[model samples]
Target: MENINIKQSDGAASLAKVYAIANQKGGVGKTTTALTLGEALTREGKKVLVIDLDPHANASVHMSYFPETVTTSAHDLFFDDADFKSLWGKIVKKREWVGFDFVPASIRLSELEVDLKDRKNKGMVLSNSLDEVKEYYDYILIDCPPHVGVLLVNAIVAADIVLIPIQTDFLALYGIRLLFDTIKILNKVLPSPVKFRALPTMYDGRAGACRKILNLIRRKLGDKVFSTVIHMDTKFREACASGRIIFDVDPKTRGAQEYMQLAREIVRNENA
Candidate 1:
């Protein structure tokens, strides 16, 4: 497999490609996509780091770290005035998901929205924090929360791409427009070369409604919709319950296969 050519500037290290998995709708499989896709990328020999920005920390739990037990979390990195690198090193946790690492989230992150209310340049905190360590990985995936808040803004400001995971349901479709509107407003401010795409998740081909929604999304979004769709599978929930990724629970499952295909598409598109 060919690796992506990292572009450096002025002798500074090339930063990792940051992809923020976000959707204003809940139960859209954001955490699942972030974790599974990161693992798939790791399987391809690329260094990947998944940052759980959601206070729920479902990705952290999937990585075998309970939210309550995590000491130094992404929350600490944002609020604490300690050494950035030291805090980062301490917060980042190594996972058995092929060689990928992740910075777990704590419930305390839920308080950030109100905590940073009047702070100057609060939107750029996540971006500034990531700049220090982005060179260490080839890709960084951020699992954002299900609502529009300071955390989501920080993730968007820091990301090079926004990967929206929308479930193949009518309710999930309702929030797509709102999410894009938010991104549009954010783009005006940050002005970074951030790309956006929609990925259909929790897809069940047998369900007529699922097929219709998928087709509708493709027709409306065109090339912005990923060709690979994450099919609905019970193994996904089982893996979460077992505190493991789909590949670890059953590599041959449709869930694993779809995520691997999604990872390949991401690599092909980004590296092209």
Candidate 2:
């Protein structure tokens, strides 16, 4: 991958391409996309780090780190005053099987909205924290919660690109507008507007409604919509349940193939 051209707060160039996988709608494959794409990027020999910002900790559980069991997690980044260099080893857990590192989430993150409500520059907290260690990886993917809150704002502010996974359904379409509006408001104060792409997920070709919605997304969004469409697959659920990536469970499956293609597209796009 080519250099991302983003700079840290200290004026040093950042090595990682930070991607926030976000959507205010639930069951839209936000966590799935984050994990699967992290796995796919590793297949291409990229160093990847996935940060679970969701209080629900679905990604943490899938990666075999429970919210209650993890010694330290992403939650600490928000509340702890220690330098990230000292906390990095403790917060970032490596999964050898998946070939990536991740910052797990805990239930404590659920209370951050209330805890940080009065804090100054709260949205920049994650961004500032990530600047301390972004050079260690080639890509950093954040799995954001399915809601409009301080957590989601922090993720978007910290990201170079916000990858919105949109399920191919009517109600899912409404989520795009909500998130876009949020991004618009954020851009007013951001140094630069956050870049974003819409990814169609859970598509079933047999369902006419799914096909129509996919078409509508592309028609309305144009090139903002990714060329790769993630088809509905039971293997993804199985892999999550088994704590394995799709490539490990069955690389031959369509779900695995699509994510690999998506990774290649990202690599090529960055290189371009």
| Model number with the top lDDT | 2
TM-scores for every predicted model = 0.92, 0.93
Tens-digit lDDT track for model 1 on 70-184?
7778898678655776667677777544467788889999999889999999999999888877877889999999888899999988998899998999999878888888888
Candidate 1 lDDT: 0.85
The collision pairs in model 1 are none
Q: How does residue 259 of candidate 1 score in lDDT?
A: 89
After aligning candidate 2 to the native by TM-score, how far in Å is the CA of 34 from where it should be?
A: 0.6
lDDT of 2 by residue, 1-272 (tens): 11122223344354789999999888999999999999899999887889999999999999888877787889999977567666766788876688777889999999998999899999999998888778777899999988889999999999999999999999998888899999999999999998999999999999999999999999999998899999999999899889999898899999999999999999999999
For model 2 the local lDDT of residue 176 reads: 86
Judge candidate 2 against the unseen true structure and give its global Cα lDDT, from 0 to 1. Answer: 0.89
The CA lDDT at 47 in model 2 is 78
Clash count for candidate 1 is 0
RMSD of 1: 4.6
